[model samples]
Target chain A: MPDNLQQALGASTNEPTASSKSNLKKLPGDLAMWFFILAELTVFAIFFIGFAIAENLNLVMFAEGKAQLHKVAGLINTIALITSSYFVAISLHSMRVRNDRQAVFRLILALVFAAVYIVIKLWEYESLFEQGIDIETNTFFTLYFLITAFHFMHILLGMVILVYMAKNAYQGKYNDSSSESEFSGFESGACYWHMVDLLWIILFPLIYVI
Target chain B: MMKFWQRYALSWGWLIILTMASVAIGQYFQYATLNSVLFIAIVMLIIALKGQQIVDVFMELKHAPSLWRNIMLSYVIVVPLIITLIYI
Candidate 1:
């Protein structure tokens, strides 16, 4: 069999021999991390569906609420989060290559991008508050605040994870071995950060544009 | 073969282009007299594309185990479909 097919079959069977296991396509990060990601995505899916249902019921209110949002700020936040995800992905590549210094640098860059997201989000929230908008404003604003604030908290946690990964990379913790599992923790952290980015991509359109 | 980082950069470029396209589409729908259902469909389609890029390229799930990869990929599809259903 071709190498790619062989690897796929090995992975599917979940019974690769020791040698084949080395060549099988594997999920990045710990299995537990993937489960965690799935759980988080499920919760966000519920929130997204709820928002859509609410919008369906009150089209005028939802339209008005969306109009009040800062689309430019939403655009910038999307760019920041996507850029941060790219940096985190590159940092993982660096770690795999045992380039600890570059890994740490890229991770720090990712954190900087995330910080941009934080500042913009807080600014947007403050602007809304100044306009006398809050969760109790209406069903539209209620779901808006509930969903975005929940996501904002996730960004903060993702940043903390990035910082921890950066410190570990700088300390050469992930560069100690060629084993992929050695850096699974770093991969898990990167996955969480990307999950944050992924959620924002959908949220941007749902709340601000659509 | 493209270097991993180079591939990632290409994906990032495409993501930014898609983001710009979505914003333009959103702005156009705001003024155009087109069908709102069509607008929602286009926006959701763009969103699905963006989500897929993040899952496959940024998250490096393209070569992952089938079950996990399918689950994430399905999110990119299912959520948009649900939103489209609600909007339309």
Candidate 2:
């Protein structure tokens, strides 16, 4: 296989040393994909700092804007993200056993979670629009829309990647001929999903707790 | 720590605990000038540690060509330090 393709597929050379292949995997592979994760994290951190600055400048507005947010929607998104994280964890576990079908199934469920979050987020946005608030209304709205929209963009990207992984799985790319490591697609997918979840973890407080 | 750290504790456990602690600290103490810098540094460290652990285990950058790993590691360290200097 081509190096680039192999990288996407995330297959290590099938030559597993005795020490390497010895037992159950306790954790997912920590890959360069994490830096991809880190970039998203950095972006969220910037938004968070902006939130802090805004709060200091106008605590009342920040507090009022936060109260305007749909707490139930936010909570649902949190649950979705957490549920998706669980699926990613399961997908990795399935990958360890070389159970390609099970891994793909778990990943698809994660996609469903993402979609659920987006739908509810859209509902929340529309309701806010009806309330005469928007990105240009003030700094708080601007930051709120920007952060959530940026997050939605990431969900879309993750969906695309997960879709590709699922398709490849159905094609038997992970059939018995290959070891689990031979397929890095799911690994990368799961990592990205975790990044999304981590951002939401921060956002939960930024939008609601504060 | 590809093998060693992986053997000790799942890295995510460390990540979750650190993050929760950060959140608690963020909640109790308002962001003062000194506090902001201190918290930011702590957050940066968490991000760095989690990122490095993930790279080592998931990407197997540790198993890839050493030169590639070294080069990327340099970028990882330098980029955040520069970010700190510029932002702070």
Candidate 3:
């Protein structure tokens, strides 16, 4: 897609016109973001149902199992994700303001949050397992491990993208693009980061509250 | 009035408020079983709305070529329902 918004308002951003950037078409970044989201949601749905089913058989045990989780750790992860989402927004906003340098900086901030999220999640999981609550022991841990393990994977992927975008900016690939390429890359990054944030949104309550 | 609403009243503002409200209600109804379920549902709803808003506004899919925007939105909406129908 050409970056000329005056022209692109009537055009599709999916059709990258720059021959040099044709490989971008193959990635289909937006659709891929949502596709991964759908798949993750499907996995979470199974975990949720399994949890409820186990609850039906043994509500008290499930409740006891849930109470064992660390609320402080969960809240910390929630704050980290929420802050990363903010950084994602700031990065996108900086791009709109034509500040590529600032955009890269904000993405690094998001990466920091993703790293903190991973560290806290692993620490929490280790502590929980030490308490003798394995995923196979019951429904609570079953849902907990599946949801968090998948989210940990996403944090890893987002960190990779952040690093890639940072390197691309260093090389000036994203800086000189037509308005469309810049906007497209920035928006796609936000789309992916937001997907990460959205997963944690649902995961937080699943593991923490309900 | 509408422009003001669109700016200050961006959907996420309302969503954050709704999130806070849900948390408050969860605290008050601490032991209510169905409310716990509702709490999670509300959180999911906010996240869904936020995702759609990002795609629609920042991605500019809202004003994109109809074929792309419609189909994309359709998948976004349908995927969640299909997940629920098949699992939850």
Candidate 4:
């Protein structure tokens, strides 16, 4: 099998022979993480559909609203989130290879990149507020604030989870040899963080570009 | 023939390039042309692909069960396609 497929299979060659074989059918991360991911995605999908319909109703206003948005800031945030997601993935990969110290390091790196995203986002929001574009300004501004603010809350939550996971890793709570449930913190946190990134990928284009 | 970071780096590289491309296209349509279906269609395509990259690689859904993977893949493709058709 290809290397990425093998990694995606949650297989690291260093695992003991028994666990390596057994892990093949197991999904990465806690089962509860999948449930949360599904719920989060569903809510975002509804919001996205709602935005689409609203934009169709008021195309000119939506276009003008999008024009007021700082596309360069959105673009910068996109890169930051994407880079943070990359670090999060690598952090999880480090744990799977049983490098708990390295995992902690990578998780901190992820948090730093996520912080960059938050700073840029807040700057963008401040610019909008200075321009007198608040949530009650119009339908387009309303949806933009509602959706992006909701997504911003998720990013904050993900950061908290990452911090807790990093603490756990510091205490050596996770390793590839550990039981799946014991490793839930790392996987669950990483999954939620990625969901945030996933939502932003669509959100960026929908509100800022499209 | 590749290390793990190399594969991830490739994904990141693609993401950055596509992001810049989408922004440029967005600007072109905004300032130069109005009511262009092709521009909306192109932006929609980029959105779907970016969503796919996040689900498949960042989330590692590619190795997930077919049911899980297909569910996400459908969202990435269908949602933007619908919006594009309606708006464009």
Best by DockQ: 1
- When only the first chain is scored, the TM-scores of the models are 0.88, 0.82, 0.78, 0.88
Distance (Å) between predicted and true CA of A79, model 1? 0.2
Q: How well is each residue in A12-127 modelled by candidate 2, as lDDT tens digits?
A: 33334555443312223345665666566677767766766666677678768887887667767766766666666656555555667887898889889888998999999999
Tens-digit lDDT track of model 3 for A1-210? 453332323222322345524323222234555566567656655665565566567768767877888866776777677667666665655554556788789788888988898889889888887888787987667766877887788778877877777666656565464535654554566667766766666566555655
Better of 1 and 4 by DockQ: 1
TM-score for each predicted model, relative to the true structure: 0.91, 0.63, 0.70, 0.90
Compose the digit string of candidate 1's lDDT tens values, residues B8-68.
9999999999999999998998899689889889989998999999999888787778788
TM-score of 4: 0.90
Span of ten consecutive residues with least summed lDDT in model 3 chain B = B1-10
Tens-digit lDDT track of model 4 for A1-210: 132234434545433255555445445576777888888988998899899899999989998998898988888899999999999988887877778899899889989989998999999999989988899999999999999999999999999999998998888766434444557557668878988998898899889887
Better of 1 and 4 by TM-score: 1
Q: Give the alpha carbon lDDT tens digit for every residue of B9-71 in model 3.
A: 364454455445545555565665564444545544554565465456534455455665565
DockQ of candidate 2, scored on C-alphas against the true complex (2 decimals): 0.09
Full-model lDDT for every candidate: 0.85, 0.62, 0.60, 0.82
Q: What would the per-residue lDDT of candidate 1 be over residues A1-210, giving only the tens digit for each residue? A: 133223323433423466765466677777898899999999999999999998999989998999999999999999999999999998877775567898889988999989999999999999999999999999999899999999999999999888988888787766554533547788788889989999999999999887
TM-score top scorer: 1
- C-alpha positional error of residue B33 in candidate 2 after TM-score superposition, expressed in Å: 24
* Candidate 4: regions farther than 4 A off: A1-10, A14-25, A176-179
**CAPRI quality of model 1:** medium
Ranking by TM-score: 1, 4, 3, 2
True contacts kept of 3: 0.11
lDDT of 3 at A137: 84
